[model samples]
Target: MHQFISVTFSLLVITGLRVSVQAGETRPERSISRHYISELTVTNGGRWGSWGHKEMCPTGTYAAGFSLKVDSAPYAQTNDITALNGIRLHCIDNYRRSLNQYHEYSTVRSEVGSWGRWTDIKWCPSGFLRGFALLVEKPQNTGDNKAANNIAFVCSGGAVLIGSGTNWGEYGAWSKTCEGKGICGIKTRIEEPQGSGDDTALNDVTMFCCS
Candidate 1:
């Protein structure tokens, strides 16, 4: 299940610039608000699972941060194939601000999996991390695996290095980022090993360079 929240704020400005009290008489400022939604799908057993649905920010808000959890490496000590466990998003509400993130996920589910906690927000120095598209794959049914293998974040420059997984699925082509003017940031979440015979997955992403 996904959860969302909306926040509203006001910024005082004059003549396309922020004015202090001494600059001039106080003028009424425009008020704006935005809603943020978090969406996810049930987990799968192996690498042949469906792609998780995508979660977009509200009409007036753009993606500012993102987070994902996966199953991989030592955590999957049984060497069972893994898939996406969780997904999250952070958005900023700016009527004229640019879009920051774009994403897609598998639509199939083979088995049920667990989800980890959300990660902290990440931001760029001068702009938001621009998102391009998503890549998804499902590996063959073998080695304790039969679900969506891995998903990749295709950025403005290139694909996000999310690490290894089953290598038998589909790849979503790249797309253009959203329209707007602002910097970008990267949000990531990883689930470590808890106890014996636990699975592990890395959910790290790269940031967009501010120019």
Candidate 2:
């Protein structure tokens, strides 16, 4: 009986199915798989008048998402002509990994309007991306300062894609969902009101990924 039990145990180990003993019965030990963040990087558009400083995530951790604070703070009696505000980077451990590392900046382009380019989106290595969150500026009025207020994201087999929402004058909120087919990266958009003289920007974005 001892030799038979020893042979059975060896076979289980060889086949990657170690047995567990519980309540006088034997069962296979279930395997638990987990994921974690590996690295993070950041950059920005070289605009004038200190829009904010660049930031990075800790080594071996991933960004949870992003947030922003405008210089004028929506409805101010006196708005800033042009000044860099503050920005934040939400960080997470293994449970949440995502992406869309971008920043945009623009100055008053005459009465025609304030315009800026969508900062290039960042992607994860091959099949590591999973989902994302966004932090739009969303000011109260669209006269002197502008910020991205809405955004959208999609995770598919080939690549992750992003788009902007309709409202441009008010910062909405972070995205509700973070599940992606295989979210590997992030994209961003910036818009200005159809008037003259307001520097608007999409300050930053956060991304998540799988281990």
Candidate 3:
């Protein structure tokens, strides 16, 4: 059976702002300026790690592209593999520009594993990212385990963009499409380095959509 941890956070949304109110303090400690209307998730995520802080796109931008932090083949073959380490959301203010011409944009990511190089950004041809699917490896009893291996995104224009991640697992079902403009935020579940135990890096992920 797969083993993992679930993290809970107290979130307060008011007037298009997301505030985090931990268990103790009276006032909010941090606030995200952007507002998300819904969340996207998959069922085949590997079981491991704790959920990281949610990272959001800027107030007026949405995710139109993404990049992956991956441990390439040769490196993975020689070391304890952590195939997919991180996922980054590339955000832009304008969705009307041509796919090949994004002169200005911002990138955001949640907590990431420590053993990979970031791949080049992959853009959606026509519109913003609306949904996603993950390729995840099942738990290998006593064997080397690399939880998440690859990812794919569904654009609003019906085009799909796949990341250059390791080929170790099968792609799970696509997440439910966004209910608003597009995806605007991300939260990742990442496994920390295990001193001598089998290490599985990125385990699961969730996407946020905004209006």
In order of listing, the candidates' clash counts read 31, 14, 0
Q: List the candidates' TM-scores in order.
A: 0.39, 0.29, 0.82
Name the lDDT value of residue 79 in candidate 2: 46
lDDT of 1 at 131: 45
In the range 151-193, model 3's lDDT, one tens digit per residue, is 8777887766767788787777789999898999999999998
- Put down candidate 1 lDDT per residue, 96-139, tens digits, no spaces: 22332222211111122463332233322223335432334433
Report the candidate with higher lDDT, 2 versus 3.
Answer: 3
TM-score of model 3 relative to the true fold?
Answer: 0.82
lDDT of each: 0.32, 0.30, 0.77
Candidate 1 vs candidate 3: the lDDT winner is 3
Which has the greatest TM-score? 3
Error of 2 at 36 (Å): 15
